[model samples]
Target chain A: MRDKVVTAAEALAEVRDGALVAFNFWGPGTPLHLMRALQERGVKDLTICTNNYTLRADVLREQGAVDAAILLPQTRKIIVAFSGVQQEDSSASVEIARRVQEGTLEIENVSHGLFIERLHAGAMHLGGIYSPIGIGTSLENGKEKRVINGVEYLFQEPIVPDLGLINAAKADTLGNLVCHGTARAANPVIAMASRYTVAEVFEVVEPGGLDPDTIVIPASFVDRIVRIPDDDPYSRERRVEQTLRSVKYRLEKMAEAEAEAAQGGGA
Target chain B: MKEKLTEELVAMRAAKELVPGDYCNLGIGIPLNCAAYAAEGVLLESENGVLGYGPVHDRESLDENIERVDWDIADAGMRYLEYVPGMSFFDMLTSFAMIRSGRLISILGGLQVSEKGDAAIHSTSKDDIASKIGGSMDLSWGAKRLIVTMTHCSKDGSPKIVRELTMPVTTRGRVNLIVTDMAVIEVTSSGLVLKEFAPGWTPEEIQEQTEATLTIAPDVREMEF
Candidate 1:
């Protein structure tokens, strides 16, 4: 069997300028190290499809955790699922808005499910999924619509990205992956949806070291595995602490609102 | 003459819809308070792919339910959660599958609801610089029953119950119920029916606040619990 484990820079070499990149951003499974690596690689004119377009980083930073913010110039276009959903006007989101206004970047916004379903279509090699998600809103524009079972549904097209950057808790030499918690999200799908898939993993084990039942992404779908450099085990612990702080912050705000309402006669 | 219901009360009213053994997803903002008031057996799901969990309010609760706590496992709103018994996690695709399959009842915070049951939970500016339509579309379209918990009026005090939606629509004719600060409106084919009003607020007062004409249910009464 070929050696699939390589350094982050070596794996990122496969990514070229103008590549259509895909990132699994819906959960803690985001390939943060790989994203930062790509930003360092300085690939230009890349069109990236992701769930959150740099919005997560800003939120994390506010909570005092160091988020891996990819500040790549000439990103060209971003096809995002959730943009400022929390109504958070983060610097990254603000920059995206500014870039759009400056005609420096283009963006395509789709609903969360359809975004994944479109990628699933490409991975499964099937016709695009017919979803009624955006049928009513302005999202109905320029899409093929059909009435299936007397209900109107829009046909979404498959999007096979040139490269998929994914994260995993562990990977074997043959590239079988194991993801932790909800972090398993999008890793399997992105591996199958992209032409070339590279993973940023916490650990690299020899083949057969991992039980077959434990592997989430099989070896065949993954092309390379890069163990995150200088991996700190305390990273998640710090983030958890920060999350608790934010929760306390929310509670404090709620109490203040309640106090204000009480003084205002519940108006 | 009387006070309006608080955001927490609106969420409490919405939580009544989540009986035991029901799977539920709550939107951000006021709807998030539904977690605190959810039925004991309710399985709370988040778009980030967690189910069978409850929101973690502070460190003490986290330590109490810390058996399988994955600190990295944050909810869609970026809130850390407590992993209760029977709690399991899945990927985003599977998470959304459950959402679009009519298994989860969603309580969402809406921007507006039309008389015809059309919901406009998402909004975007004309500049079209960036649009954020999260799981609102799927939830509104596929929830077993969609209940919107919001205030009756916008910050400017304009009615959110409207004759027609002027904002970006999320789903057409999908809202089953609306629990606002002033009243509980049932969206029917005929019109928006005023089912229950807050204490001291009458159907006529709600109708006056609403942009669309409200059809008062024959048995309308003051909201309880």
Candidate 2:
């Protein structure tokens, strides 16, 4: 069998223009290292699916942006479950809002549960699943709804992406992945659903270094692995900055709103 | 009139609804604070894939001991959480499976709730690209019990509990209970029933603040801690 571990560039070499890429981007599941490499690759007209669009815009407001979403200029649309601005005008978007206005971007809103279930179906090769989660909401729009056992359920379609960018805590030589803590989000599912999955791991060890019982993504599902260095700035330093910025913005916004409310009450 | 219920008080009142051994999930904003005031027995689930977590580290608490904040153990909201004895984490599939399968109860913040039990938590405008509908759509049906904790009115003094929701709906006709700043209302098969009110407010005053006409419960009394 071919070596599972490879350089980041080699692992991401197949990613081309117009590729359908999926990312495990919720909280610590984000494949930040690989996402940055892809952005530098300058791919275009791509359709990417992810959980959130930059975690409340802290990543997007900066010129560097964050995640693969920094590929906004080259990208065509984002199929996201949660993509929105925290503040309508200020601090939220210097990039996303412009794309929506130009008709260059489209947002496909979905329920969080059904979104993953759709991917679950994709990974398992199932036709679809009947869901009642968003039955009477906007998510029911343009979807086939059927009654099962006297309860209304909508049909959720499976989505298989061309490439998957996922993060795991560790990977062995055999390509098995171990994603610990809350970081174990959609990574395993993305590995199974995408045609070719690339994992960004903190470390790569010998085959037996990872406990077989704890491996979340098996070798057959993961195509390649790229280990992010322990001292990588993307791992901790950057998030600390982002978190501080987010906290400061939130506090300032709260203060402004409180001041406005006080003025209104006094009058 | 007495002091209006702060966000903390609204959360405290919602915390009263949590029972021992009940698996609960809280939305962002006012509902997230319920964890601080809630009893320890209830198992909390975060939608970004955590189950049976202990109290989360807040900015105020972390200000004293900043080292307690583990960036890796954060929820989807980026809040660092504490791990309890039997705390376990799973992928989003298992997380939502537990949610949609009615294994967890969801307490969420809201912008508007209709008399007919429709809730609009995510966005006020249907076409607003600036707001997101994260898991509220799924959380609305987490279980037979969906409790909404929010301010009685918007910051601009507009009534949020209304005859019909003018905002984008998260889910329709499924809100079971609403704990607001001024009143604790229940959604009965018949209509919205006002069960309790804050100390300085009467059912009449609460109704005045609400756009929807409220049916006062027979045993309606001042809200208790």
DockQ of 1: 0.52
- Top model number, lDDT: 2
**Which residue ranges in model 1 land beyond 4 Å of their true spot?**
A56-72, A85-90, A231-267, B57-69, B124-128
Q: Once model 2 is optimally superposed onto the true structure by TM-score, how far is the C-alpha of residue B157 displaced, in angstroms?
A: 2.7
Q: Tens digit of lDDT per residue, candidate 1, span A21-73?
A: 98887547877677767877888899988877634445545654333235437
**Residue B62 CA error for candidate 1 (Å)?**
8.1
Candidate 1: which pairs clash?
none
When superposed on Cα atoms, how far off is each prediction in RMSD?
A: 3.5, 2.6
Task: Give lDDT tens digits, candidate 2, residues A42-66.
Answer: 8889887888775354433562436
- Worst lDDT run of 10 residues, candidate 1 chain B, spans B57-66
**Worst lDDT 10-window in candidate 2 chain A:** A56-65
lDDT per residue for candidate 1 within B1-225, as digits (tens), equals 468999988888889888899999989888899989988999999887889887564544664554466666778876666656788888888989999999999989999999998988867354455567878898889999999988899988898989899888888999999999999999888888999999998898898999998889999999977
- Per candidate, native contacts kept equal 0.67, 0.68
What are the Cα lDDT values of the candidates? 0.80, 0.82
